[model samples]
Target: MELILALAIGVLFSSGIWLILRPRSFQVITGFMLLSYAVNLFIFITGKIHINKAPLTLDGVPVDPTRYADPLPQGLVLTAIVIGFATTALYLVVLLGSRGLTGTDHVDGKERDHDE
Candidate 1:
């Protein structure tokens, strides 16, 4: 499971980087989203995967690291998701406004001449 997850994260990160290098504004936005997802997944994975375990222990109970899930990563991932969504929305609005004013979706504010 860990190997599979690592591979998935690598793929997402690579694809996101490739898209980020593109000249299209929409593709850049998508790349940022993908990168954010990879980061969230990494944060979640760091908390470790514990099956059938509680997030916290009672005050009287003995604390065992293996038996309890770490809640910090979960909370961080949740917060990151919310922030990523808001940032994505803001980027989309900016992209729309730029497109309307400049009449192009390219990051350079002009279309690339592919014939060269």
Candidate 2:
């Protein structure tokens, strides 16, 4: 399980770096997504993984909380997921507006300037 998590982290990191290096704004968005996923995974792995563990208290039974996985990471990941979605949506809107107004998506605005 740990190996799988490690492999996933590596792949996500590589993908994020690759997308971030691209000149396109859309690729940069993808890179951000990948990086966020990698970060969430790393945070989760720090807490360690457990199997067949109960999430909460049971009737008349004292359970060892350490034997179960931490719920904090899951909540954090959910929050991150929502925030990432919002960020991606906002980025797309800005990219589209930029392209529509300037007639180019490039950051340097060379395509629009050439038209003048």
What tens digits encode model 2's per-residue C-alpha lDDT throughout 1-116? Answer: 99999999999999999998876777888898899899888877676676776556677877777766777777777888888789888988888887788777675444554453
**For model 2, where is the 10-residue window of minimal lDDT?**
107-116
Residue-by-residue lDDT tens digits, candidate 1, 21-47? 998999999999999999999998998
Off by over 4 Å in 2: 111-116
TM-score of 2: 0.80
lDDT assessment of candidate 2: 0.80
Which pairs in model 2 have colliding backbones? none
